[model samples]
Target chain A: MVENTTHSEPSGDDIRPPKASIGVIGWLRANLFDGWLNSVLTLVTLFVLWKTIPPFFRWAFVDSLWFTDGAVCRDAPGACWSAVTTNLRFIIFGFFPYELQWRPLLAMLILFFLLFYSRDRTHWNKYLAYGWVIGLFLMGLFMKGGLFGLTPVDSTQWGGLPLTLLLSVFGLTAAYPLGVILALGRQSSMPAVKYLCIIYIELIRGVPLISLLFMGSIIFPLFLPEGITINSILRAQVAIILFTAAYIAEVVRGGLQGMSQGQYEAADSLGLNYVLTMRLVILPQALKIVIPPTVSILISAFKDTSLVVIIALFDLLKTSQTVLSNPEWMGFSREVYLFVAILYFLGCFSMSNYSRRLERELDRGY
Target chain B: MTIADAEKVPFYLNPKVRAVFFQIGVLCMVGLLAWYLVSNTLTNLERQNIASGFGFIQKEAAFEIGESLISYGSADTYGRALFVGVLNTLKVSLIGIIATVILGTIVGVARLSSNWLVSRLSKIYIEVMQDVPVLLQLFFWYAIFYESLPSPRQALNPVAGVFLCNRGVAVAIPEAHPAHAYILSTLVIAIVAVFFLRRWAKTRQEQTGKYFPVFRVGLGLILGLPTLAWVAFGSPTAMDVPVLQGFNFTGGMTLSPEFIALLLGLVLYTAAFVAEVVRAGIQSVSKGQQEAAMAIGLRPNLVLNLVILPQALRVIIPPLTSQMLNLTKNSSLAVAIGYPDFVSVANTTMNQTGQSIEGVALIMLVYLMFSLSTSAFMNWYNKRARLVER
Candidate 1:
């Protein structure tokens, strides 16, 4: 097929594209200035950034007063970062014995370690579950500290970041199995159990979390016999668990419904009992399908732990408020709030990012 | 032999028998717990001498609410105060839902923009707003409103008849007149007419391959009819401009600081979630659909209206409804900012009357009613939006 035609192949250098269509300039043209409207939009955004960024930077960093006393901060023209830096301990650990603050810190470190370890799906097994159980017990022991010759700090003393993590983490851990059970009940053929589960789920979901918290605080006390009292923190914890379980049940129910009828029929053909079928076939797939949504629910529950502040518990948000209420730190609310918000943002952002990654990974498997 | 074997099965081992037994056990346990709790509650109430019924709702509230829709005094009954709270809650939720939809749509579209900076900025907005705890955001906004704003004497008047101060934002509104009522009625009529016109146009388009400019006509009818009514009744020009009197602005309508802070926080927070829902909805529509519409010589806007939105809306509505319900529920956070919402008012009632049971029950009942009604309406709308299949 070598016809005698006067043709020559292009060299690599000749094949190279023009500079205007490949590098940073190319990106700018294609993404930021693809059309007249895009170019205008790019310019307007830049203008807005120019207007906002400099002032914010100057206030937050340049003119900010850090490592200073309240008297000095009051006179400063910008943000008072000292409010956060000086009271950082109180803000992070709250009213836990000041000398024993390391206990709570250690507890949080363990919690974080457990969370980080569990992030890898390959490590998710019976040992990980055992690890969580042991870790939770250690955390409680450290926070309470009656055993191991440690000072006996009451549950009432628990507050700040540790308290926030404890409520959400403990609440979610206890809630997941209950939520699954509720979902199974809702899907059961027995009308009584199904209706009961439906009522419980809808009742919890219909009202706001605050209402349930109110019942916990105000009505639950009256429901107890005289001289038998429960701590407000425990009450709030119960409320959060009950509230979150309902939401998780709904998400798990979606997963259950999404399972094909063929899967169930196959289990039946294998002569598996209902429990065995659910345990070996249904729940494994359903729970995996619902991991992303369950994570979302957990993240929201984490955020909602702040609502305990309304009930007068000293979570991170409440600690910040307590600090702000002091006469010495009266005017540094913006700084204190910004710091707390960053803490919350980090927790939420990481969880959501992990969920997205997990979603993609799960998608690849199928 | 099969029937005889089934009858020979042990009652405890039979699946149906076990199911019945389990249900009865659950019912018994639940009933026992309820009985125990009620007995304890009664004994405790008697010991504390706290009146248990809702009889306190008739008593004088004796506490002044910071804001109310209707004229309310400390002498007003608790029932009246509760009603006012419900109205305030509805007002905020309705306005917040509308604003959230508008802002969320804009942000969602911007996130999909071809412009890099625009999309990036919107992404940043969604991330930051979603990541922050909403209660914290509410506190932030409330701080800005209460701490940063100037006093009434030093109010910032950025426009002619608008005042911004620590007290609240006061904006001039048209003076009340009979013509205003007529104009409102005319607007309602125009809305009804447009509804019928849309149906007629849809049928006409289906029967005959023709298009109708229903939007333009509807807009014209709504606006023109209102204007005509105003003109026929001698168009009123007077406005109730705000004027500073004593320590506060008088005359113009003032949005309380609590209301503004609550509204702002709810809209900004909920809009982020709504934007994500909308983005997912739009993305769910395959690119081929748009290309196919464009291939048929439809204009870009026409492609969106005729092909894309109808499909995207099906995916958007269900999640959007939940977001709306979330906003409604989150409005209960108004208690944190002291916004005299239903929960806050009920909380006050509980504290005052010591009728915690009644107060808590009312709160649950009202919220349940709201949730049920909202879901019912949304379910209807979702059915309408669903794809029709043979």
Candidate 2:
């Protein structure tokens, strides 16, 4: 009887909907538990989450000490948030005059605002260049204030997020032009120029940044005339600039290699000289193609500024380490390091995301 | 095209003349700069009373290194101390590279998994790890390990014969025994045997149109032969399990906390980049490939092994090599945490002997050698990976 019923054609009104895997439950069944192995994996992942997350939440949030003194946190069973909050000012402006902390604060604001303004490629013109020049001058004036009646803060006293931004911004800005010139020189018809560029780039790229920083601190001073001392921070900044230029030269050369031969011929037919041809035609297109990789180099260079810690410069990372080294806040390195990591993540992530967006927007069909 | 037209050009305007003049200008400027710098450096060295030469490398290095691959002491020669540092750097880099490849490949493939949870978790891991500076991560990890772990007296014993404490982590290993040499010889033999067996299997399959399970057979030869040799030799090697002593664990192998932290920092940070490279390489292979292989009745594993990976390797190897080199260079960050790597050792030497130039030169020379050798190997691999056409 059941077989006969199945054999009969279904009436239109009695027709049933087909079962489909679409919603959350369906998705779980299809993705998480599609087979025995997947089911096992899903269970294992759940078990791991179960083991780690609850305790993490409890330690980080539920029982965490906030807005309290070190004395209160001494016996607390969870994280000491008060350590970071209490020493936040010291961490942000290491060794700078406590009263003049507002200067770095203002400088950071200017730097960030300028960075935000420069993100718009359509507005990239002479005005943008002028804006960077003015912004950097203002930042330097505010931080090193022997002018305008503000107390002068020595470069050695510069630290924390402001120092990080200063190093990365100035290092990248100064390095880009030098890198482009080196790349062009490497491609020159003259052997002397080409080999000079090659040796400079290769030799710099061969050594680690730490050694370069050491050279800047120790060996470089030896190279200078007697009693002609540079600011330690200035030395480190120059080291970063030279080190970054080498990597950027390699990347720019790659971009140059990507340019079609026809473009070169077109420039030649237009009667453009070498510099004119590269500036008016080659660089624009080549630079556009290399934006993603260039941004990557810039981001890594930004992070490499943290290596200034080894040279005893109190950059963001070094400042955090200084904060944790205090006996009162010694056990609170987790909170301090976490805060520093968040700051760096914000800088690096935004740059990378912007680069991806630029890559997508600039990709005009080959 | 005429002689008169060529002769009419001014010297300044001539491209050839300009090129030659520019080259001369560059050479002169470089020569002047070098002359000035070398003269100034010589003066400074004389003033500072710092002897500048490679001779200082042979002097006794009185500072202790926290970790070294080979036996090293404060009494070791500066050259030997530097070599120990190099070995330490290589140890971290080699192990880090291996761990990174495996972790990167897994996370990379998981990024493309149909499982929503798996892919999202992988994506989150890559993004978070990549965004943070590695030095900061190293400090964080070192601090966490120190804070979370109990003192040596109350060290956490998660497994038998393994201890974890603020000092470090100690894991058990098989103690060297009399038959160890025989066991190693057997391993070499197994490897050679597998190579020949694979060749024979390939030839036989080509002739008879039958497939042999070469992988399973090869695994058996490599693993089984060594085990068999060990058993026949009366199990000469035994586990050298670590045990908690008064102040520290004594026994098998102990990794210093600094080393652990640096290794974690380098491997985790670089794996994120490696994962991206892997994902890009796999994506560069067209989607039609898997379908084509499947239509030909190849199993899923065979489809991946024979069709997908070989093509993907061409895309992956270049970026992967660069990431490896990056990781190698990054091991220098060991200085930040005082891990006694090459840079750290060199820094000490410079400070002690006041030989900054030679010390820095030694660091640069070693790293340059590493970078050149790595790139040379990659170039060779790239050539082998190139497509062959009739």
Candidate 3:
């Protein structure tokens, strides 16, 4: 636009370009030092970066140990990731029979493939729908073992990333149907059932996740029959599933409430039964409306899985922290924590981007 | 009209029958699951013989809390110790919420600024923060910030006699005298007087189209009343500024780095969400309000203060309330950094006494109370904030 104006009036050679700035320097000025306040901020930020970067450089590369004889890390001035480099296998899969590690890794790859394939809208309604169900069974059999040449790995030994992924994936999938039922119950014809659903959802949503996990891991035992103990990781999985169901139920209910009375009336006029109405008519729209918020909840559930480290289940965070706890890896906490943090951030950010894309695309529908 | 009245009773398609069947199916499945877990726990407990009940509440905690609302020590009951822990959680979270809301609003507005640098800085801030897990952020601040401070003897920032150190910041507390107490009482009286005066001023303005200086009155009342209090309270105990006491600073109130780190992390994290809510609320208001206010002979600030905020607040409060609730829940992450909050104390009690159910129940109840009251207060505020739509 500025260029058009400048060319139309060739009164002067300079013509005072709207953005006279050029190249990297111009971009920096426009972004970082555009005004007095911005220039001040730029200086402050530059100072901070200058102070922080060199130490990281020295620690991560120059002075740090990348590989060692396991115990030779006492002399490093910066990061000591030698322990992580050495013990990454154990951290990724704790107490799992070492030979069985390949099976879990393979299962992870298949999960990535299925999820990647399903993300495409064309694939979503086609082959991926069937593949998702099939993939779950395959991921399970391969990871837990009972199929192929893999040795059976007990659920108790399921630690680290594999366990974290299973808990979150199943937590979201199981919660989807359970949450819809709860939402329907909350909107039920009977006051007793409606009120009960309301109270259950609100009460569970109000408290912290740690308390729920605590209830499942410890209190849940008391209400159960003798001699049928659930494993720790399984208990945590149940905890996340129940927790996510309560939250997603609320979001779905909000979506249902947002729908106009006309839609319901139309469905009623068509002589659809309640089940048929919800499944074929109301829920399809409501779920679409709630897709954005529910996706954020899914992301939160993924992040919250890290909290299981507290109960001593070795999820990604716990495994990293466990590695930190060892005297052998005492000096490498910063490097290990940062590495794990990057992995978490990347996973969450990509999902957030996808959800935003879904929101925009779905919102375009009538 | 409503699906034509069904004179003949429906068969299996009857809603009642379907509901009953579903309930029975769910109940049976739950009952089986319950049976399995109960049997397993009883076997596990019996083999272990862990006495389960709330009898542990009366026992001595035998663990000292670094901070307490009511004086507590190892000699105190486990109940008292748990109370102390809950108090700490409340103390940290309450202050954290206040700080976060203020900071979040500022940063949120900054992110929407016409100024290019401020907006970019805020965007970067929000991105860098949430990407890092909050627990790790808390550790980064705790380990990297205060842990890098100079020793007490080397006291970094000296204010009057106040000292900052790795040992913690020691601040000056006022030593009140009789005059200071009188001043304090006078200040409270001044505030009440200012309140009455402002109401009269507003009434007068409505009647006569003349405005009273409300801001000046407010400032005078708040500052003068406080000053009068200081004089009346007998000049108070001159702050017992913590002088460097060997390896640690001593004498004044000490804020543990754990508290600092936890509070900062929560504030920084919550601020990002708060900013988004604020931005949305502001954007939700029609631009015509600004134009209309300008047409009516109002300044930009007047438009914002008198016209815009009144509407924007209705949009803002619901999300803001949820953000506050989130901050309260996230405070439990204090355990990761060893800041002995409610769950931490309960955890210790549970581990030592093996009274898991009672301990967890107490913690849940406390959180429920906090959450309910917060939600209730927000609902009342929303009612007040709602548009009359007349």
TM-score, every prediction: 0.97, 0.95, 0.88
Please report the candidate that would top lDDT against the real structure.
1
TM-score of predicted chain B versus true chain B for each candidate: 0.96, 0.94, 0.88
Model 1 bad stretches (over 4 Å): A1-9, B1-7
**Top candidate when judged by TM-score against the true structure:** 1
Better candidate number, 2 or 3, judged by TM-score: 2
For each prediction in turn, the share of the native Cα contacts (below 8 Å between chains A and B) that it retains comes to 0.84, 0.78, 0.50
Tens digits of lDDT, candidate 2, A232-292: 9899999999999999999999999999999999999999988899999999998888999
Is candidate 1 or 3 superior in lDDT? Answer: 1
In order, the Cα lDDT scores of the candidates are 0.94, 0.89, 0.81
Ranking by TM-score: 1, 2, 3
DockQ of each: 0.83, 0.67, 0.41
Error of 3 at A299 (Å): 0.9
Candidate 2 residue lDDT tens string, B1-390: 999998998999988898888889889999999999999999988997877678977888998988787898999899999999899999999999999999999999989887767888899899999989888899888898998899989988898878899999999988988778888998999999889998998899889988999899889889998899889889864799888788988898999999999999898999999999999999999999999999999999999998999999999999999899889988998998889899988888888988889988889999999988987898899889989988
Per-residue CA lDDT of candidate 3, range A232-334, in tens? 8778888999889999999999999988899999999999988899999999888889988998888888888887877778787777777777776764656
